[model samples]
Target chain A: MTNKRNQIKGFCRNVDEKKERLKKAFGYILKDKGFGNLGVNKVSLEAGISKNLIYRYFGDFKTLIEQYSEGIDYWTSQAEKRDYSEMTEKDVLKNLLGEQFNYLILNPEMRQLVLWGLHESNYNTTSLLKKRELFAERLILQKADKRFDGRIDYRGVVSVLMAAVYHLAAYSSVQKANFCGIDLSQDKGRKRVLDAINLILDNIYDLNEDKKKATNDNE
Target chain B: MTNKRNQIKGFCRNVDEKKERLKKAFGYILKDKGFGNLGVNKVSLEAGISKNLIYRYFGDFKTLIEQYSEGIDYWTSQAEKRDYSEMTEKDVLKNLLGEQFNYLILNPEMRQLVLWGLHESNYNTTSLLKKRELFAERLILQKADKRFDGRIDYRGVVSVLMAAVYHLAAYSSVQKANFCGIDLSQDKGRKRVLDAINLILDNIYDLNEDKKKATNDNE
Candidate 1:
């Protein structure tokens, strides 16, 4: 019984190693050829793992690709595990959006994946977008001050902000063009865009202040 | 000499007819199979015009596509010709954005083409995006009240708004999912989003008013 248990543990260790190798291979493939060229054969060849093992371990190519994608979650899979101690709602949004812009600009492969996601009928990509919205809800909408509730349409604001982020990333990735004369490819341009985002966020908070002031003035 | 002139006119007429046929075929193919499946063979087959005529008339499929795409310009092609007299600034923006949303929704072919344009390195598409910016500039920036300048980031505001429009249109086309609980697929959800957009626009104008009020109070 002791010998059998040890043998099973050894097998499990080998399986984990193979899974890690497969995942690393997928990253290499994704970085090299992007999401469009990713296939089981290429991954198997890159990882030096057999096709049978890939199938057996990950069930299918789609599942394996998804498993590999978790390492590069665009939204907040890794950040979800963190605590937001003492951070204002504004700070959270600024950092979150700023980080997203940097992440997309820095990681070409991720941008490609996201661009592919926008077009392809892939379940994992769709789910990832949905997950992103959920993360925004948890971080922004749910935590926003109650005083600014109706005055600030959190959902609309977030939606427009996110759309801006995604579009900027995608546009900068492909072309050297500017959105509204702000070239996102350059730092100055990017700063201007970020400032614009901050302005919008500030406007939301300011709306709350205006309401309060109006009431006080009347009183 | 008269016979020769008649012959020349006949030849010109034939060329125009073939060009029109090729252009129509390209549209049908785009609407049917999207930009991805568009090819010389597909266009030829659809147009019922020979490959020779296609090559002769357009020089190549790329040029042919570019020409076809100009007719379906996403911004300010047909709309540019319309009169915007007797409209407030807010009315102009609201109508412009609302029309954009409807145009994107109604024209799936255009959406796919726009999505393709975002990724692929096509000169025509790139030019179209530039033209789109110019359209926004003409409609929004050029028409915006100059007194509201500096105090309100009009360029940033327009950038974010255009980004929202493109991203929302692209997202709704590829997925059935809603953004921030707003189902863009449904009219009610779309209205909610449009309202959010209006609110943002209103905030920009309101900022100008507030600044003026503060100045007056200080005086």
Candidate 2:
């Protein structure tokens, strides 16, 4: 009985050590920005573990990536948790774009993942992409119909708006450049960019109303 | 005298051949996208020339890149040559965004260059970036005050719009997937996206008018 119990304890300890190393490997992946420096050798170096151990724990690099991808919904789920029902249309736009921009800038790891997600990859990141689309639908598209009363292409407009927010954050991080004289490296400059987004959203509302009114008069 | 004349002719012929080879090397640069296949060996192979000849003509890779950079302004200059004074604000927005979207889709090489220019590089692509900004200033920023009437952040707004246009073009090229149900691969789908852009621009005009009216009422 004593010998059996000792064996069980040893197995549990090995499992725990493997889990820790796996977590460290994932951290390295996020830091490296989408498999730029990804290899079993590199992960082992970063995790302070042996190459054989990583192969033993994750089976292979593909399996390790698959495990990491399971947590991809964390950001999207966080965005979906917010309740925008009580907010005005303008406020909704502000909250959505502002939250996205802030989240991107604040979380560089997530930002890299999102930017990497935009490109075509052999990896199975389709789940991550789908989660983002579903979040956009729930948060922005459903409200867009009533907000603009179908005056705009809700999906396309939201896509452009969201894509702008993403590219702005990603571009500003790597390049010390400004977009249209608005400095992106500074918070003040990024805020102006957000304010400009709100103005564009406001424009959408106004244009929709004008279209509706003109149609009514014509009738 | 005859020998001297022959020497001059041979020298001129060799210079012209080197120039032709250099032109072919630059063409490979655009096609390769982000200098992935660019090197003395690769360029020489593409141009059907020897590596020593390239070094003799352009001195080095840096000078070869610098020579190519001089032609980067061709597109921006073409945009600046257009007369926008006679155009309405809506038409101005249309022409600008339309030209940009169409040009991006039609000219894949230019599109690749623009996307590649977004990231930091060892190559001297700064002049290309500057030319794009200057073109924006001339085409959009200079007329923004009159079009938006100081009600909107003209610079910021133009930046978002331009960024969106770029991301759309760049994103659509690589990924087979569509964002938010907008099929970027199809002409009809792209047209809907463009229409969304026009609606957003139209909103700017309407919002500015509403702001002016509200101010008048307050006064």
Candidate 3:
């Protein structure tokens, strides 16, 4: 009876150890160099855990990716919670674009992981799209309809606004040198990107009003 | 003397044959299933050309890519020449977005090559920026300044507009899924994309007018 009890305690310890190791493995994947490119065995070795444990916990690499993807919505919501209620249209856009730019620049690993996810479309693109749709519905389209006095096509307006902001982030992240056109090692380039996004937002608001007038005339 | 003349003529014939074979090899590389995943042997075998001849003409696969990249400017110019001048701002934006959307859908192979170039930074993206700068200077910035009484930051405005358009093209090319929330394969989705661009443009124009008035009041 004592031997069986000891065996049960040992099994519980093994499960606890694996759970701790898996959490560390996730952090290692996010923080360490060459971790993204490592195979499952290499990641297991680096995490000081057995490959079988990883398989048992995460099921497979793809399942691990799905697990990670499950957290994207939470992160996106957190990012979107920056207050825009009291700001001008220009201010709102500037804040939005600025936030995205800063996040991508500060989080190179996450940015790279997002790029990998973007490239691998068969993964969790639906989750990404869901997050995007939420941003559109809650932040951009809703705000535009509320602020504007005309029959504005909110979806259309938001699409351009979102596309512009996303492009700025992408350019800064992937082709920073080409997009910035100045010294990339400094914050000057980043400022230029923000300025560019603000300008676009200003133009978009003006253009939307004009279209509303023309549509009314036609009616 | 007669034998020597025959030998010279035969040498010229062989050179011509090699050149023809190299051109055919380039086409095969561009059009074949294993494009982008190319090697010297595969290209040589597919083109029915000698490996030595492929090396002689192209130096390496990288050189071939460089040669192809050099031709992009010509193609872009040709694509840009499609008439939109007679259309309203909305129609112009619509046609532009439509053309970009269709290009991605219709030309998957070319899209793949371009995406690869974007990721690899293979071509001179600076040249692309220069072309964009020239387009903005001549078309949108100068024209808007001359025609409108609005406070417009020409460079910023143009940059945002171009970036938004580019975002649509880049997303469509890389993702192969419609972010416009409509089926890109259907006509309705195509119209929605065009309409969205138009709405964004109209709003921008209105916002510019507002900015101009605000500047006037400050003055």
Candidate 4:
């Protein structure tokens, strides 16, 4: 009985190790060659795992890709891990945007998915986008922040701000270019961008402090 | 001599037709299959033009793609055709952003390049992005209006607004998803976004009219 139990323990460890290796291989291939090269054969070759093992471990390439992709996407994985219990809804929204800016710049795999959404609208790209949209909806619209509605175009502002974050981070990461000569790729540009986001948010939310007071009084 | 002239004219007509055919094939392939399938062999096959002619007419694949891309990129082609001479610098900036928002939604080819910049940073994608950056830089920074400088973070603001436009346009064109429950792909959402952009600019520019007057008084 003891010998059988020890063998099972070793087998479970091996399975976990293989799964981790497969995921790493998936991300590496995504970063290296993008979706065009993300076939099961290519991934199996890259991972040094057999097709049978990939199917057995992760079911199929699509399942594996989605499962692995969920790990990299900010709204799906990283943002899900953050603790927003103590934060206000506005602060939470700001945190979401700030984290996405840094994540898109730093994470090439996520960046590739974001870029892939342009010309190629397939499961590989849309699924991640859907995940992001759904996640943000849950956080921003569903659970909290009904106070600011009709008072400001906060939704439009957030949409525009988030869009800019994705564009600047993804474009600048690859091309040493500028929008209006503001190269936000470098560190000096970081504070400027963050400050600008804060400034814009302040304009939309806090700048109308008296208006908010008037609304409160009327209510 | 008349017969000889007629033969030369027919030969030139065939050459022009063949070039146009090749360019059309290039765009179709880009739209249908994206860069992964956009090879000279494929384009030649699709166009039914010989490889030798593609070389003789357009030089090489890179040159052909670049030349073809220039025709489609807004800043390089369409925006270049616009008469912004009558407009003030701020108005010019507004027009630039507005045109881009509409164009990105309407033009899949340009949208593809904007989206492609996220993951695939190659000649096909980067060339278009470089063209846009240079055009905006020249228009926004070089030729006019340093009045807004030091008074505000217009560069940061523009960068953020432009970034959001890209993200919203490209993502919505595909996903039909909402950002903050605002389905900006619709016409009603268009006004909300445009108004938000105008409002942000007003907050940045006109809201500080008193401040500008104060600064002028100091001067």
Chain B TM, every candidate: 0.84, 0.78, 0.60, 0.89
C-alpha lDDT of all candidate models, in order? 0.76, 0.68, 0.55, 0.77
Question: Model 4: per-residue lDDT, tens digit, B150-217?
Answer: 67677777777777777777766766555567776687887677777877877777645756798889
Off by over 4 Å in 3: A1-50, A69-77, A80-94, A113-120, A135-150, A176-186, A199-219, B1-51, B70-77, B80-98, B122-150, B173-185, B202-219
Ranking by TM-score: 4, 1, 2, 3
Candidate 1 Cα errors over 4 Å, as ranges: A1-21, A24-49, A145-147, A212-219, B1-17, B24-38, B45-48, B85-90, B143-145, B212-219
Looking at model 2, residue A39 earns an lDDT score of 66
How would you class the docking of model 4?
Answer: medium
Candidate 1 lDDT for residue A79: 56
Q: Which candidate comes out best when scored by lDDT? A: 4
Give lDDT: candidate 1, residue B12.
99
Rank ordering of all candidates by DockQ, starting from the highest: 4, 1, 2, 3
**Range of the 10 consecutive residues with the lowest summed lDDT in candidate 4 chain A:** A141-150
- Candidate 2 DockQ, CA atoms: 0.50
Residue B165 CA error for candidate 3 (Å)? 2.8
Compared with the real two-chain complex, what DockQ does model 3 have? Answer: 0.28
> Which portions of model 4 show Cα errors greater than 4 Å?
A142-145, A213-219, B142-145, B207-210, B217-219
Q: What tens-digit string does per-residue lDDT give for candidate 2 at B1-219? A: 999999999999988888677766776666553433456777777778888887888888767766665444335635667788888756876787777777776655565455445444335555566666666667667677775667777777767777788778756665556687677778877887788777777667666788889988999
TM-score of each: 0.85, 0.80, 0.67, 0.91
